[model samples]
Target: MRVRHSTNLTRNGLTDWIVQRVSAVILAAYTLFIMAFFMCSVDVTYASWTGLFSNLWVKVFTLLTVFSIVAHAWIGMWTVFTDYVKSTAVRAFLQIGLFVILFFYFFTAVLAVWAV
Candidate 1:
């Protein structure tokens, strides 16, 4: 016999899935942009790096990339934990720990990008 889940998908879960897919698409485009930038700038000087980061559009795109990555990671990890971790206490602890680490990493990346 097949069984069904007790709980239906929550709004948060649906939103997360949508965000993850959207971000993945955006990241693919960003990858192409990076490749084109690298190919065009053969010299790879400090000025080239500064010029890329100094642009407002580049900065905004980078920030969106960072946010998307973090959201993707969080949603992916949460799914893993929910699926694989059986113990409630352990799951809760690991979820919180993962979230903290993800937040710190995202924050650091944002700060580094801003500082550039």
Candidate 2:
């Protein structure tokens, strides 16, 4: 038997499953992008770093990657807490705390990425 929580962002096991898988792919792609950039560049310098991010597409993709990371983390953490933290109050508190932290992380990432 599966337990369903009303406060879930996905609210369905299948949806959550799919989301985790998709987010993993997005994260993997982002990692590959960084790896490829390093491999193709002769020297990793400040200018090269800035130049890579200067592209609008790179900025957009970075934002998407950050968002994917937050979503993936939220779902993964929520699942763990819900499964092990049997107390409703404790689970709710943990989830809310994690949500706030993830939101802040994403917000900081956006500002750092775009300086906006």
Candidate 3:
């Protein structure tokens, strides 16, 4: 029996597993990159910080990191809700709330990264 809903993210268990793992790797790589940036930049300043993000590659990478974060959070949270939330109405409410929040984060990141 397959549960279908417009709000459902991965839909298939295998797809969900793959997505979670890939997103985790992306998030980890992003974390390491940021850590290296901070470590190398001993004298960090507003201009230096902005300079890092101003690079085209870094800007694209930042957007990708933001996307991975949202995807990772959604899958993790949705699994938790399905496992622990017994009440149908409550689970739906929580899932829908999360769905909105994740999209909002993605859009906000896009705007922030691209905006001059």
Candidate 4:
């Protein structure tokens, strides 16, 4: 005989899987857009860079990229810790550290983007 798990738990995994895929797509698209922008530009200067980010649309897209990066990193790190780190104490510690770093990155990115 076999035991069955809760549907909610199953659904949660599926949700995470879907989110990872979506975030990856977003990150890739943003990377490509930035790469193309750089390649097309004849002069790459601090003024030009700042000007590119000055656009409202670019800022919005940059914000979305930040979100995608955070989500992707969280899911990837959580999966690794859960799968490989057998020690509960060690896993919890690592997860807490990851959360702190990711949050710090998020806030810092927001500040830098909006300060411009």
- Which candidate number would show the highest TM-score if scored against the true structure? 2
Each prediction's total of clashing residue pairs, residues at least 3 apart in sequence or on different chains, is 0, 0, 0, 0
Model 3: which ten-residue window has the lowest total lDDT?
A: 1-10
Best by lDDT: 2
**TM accuracy, model 2:** 0.93
Q: Which stretches of candidate 2 lie above 4 Å from their native place?
A: 1-4
In model 1, the clashing pairs are none
Model 4: how far residue 39 lies from native, Å = 0.7
lDDT for 68 (candidate 4):
88
Task: Give the alpha carbon lDDT tens digit for every residue of 1-116 in model 2.
Answer: 35557867688889988998998999999999999999999999999999999999999999999999998998899889878988888888999999999999999999999993
Q: Give the residue spans of candidate 1 off by over 4 A.
A: 1-10
What is the alpha-carbon RMSD of candidate 4 to the true structure? Answer: 4.0
For residues 1-116, could you state the per-residue lDDT of candidate 3 as single tens digits? 23334454667778878988998898899899999989999898999999998999999989888988888888888788877887778988999899889889999989888899
Model 2 CA RMSD to the hidden true structure, in angstroms: 1.7
Against the true structure, candidate 3 reaches a TM-score of 0.89
What's the lDDT for candidate 2?
0.90
Q: Estimate each model's TM-score.
A: 0.84, 0.93, 0.89, 0.88
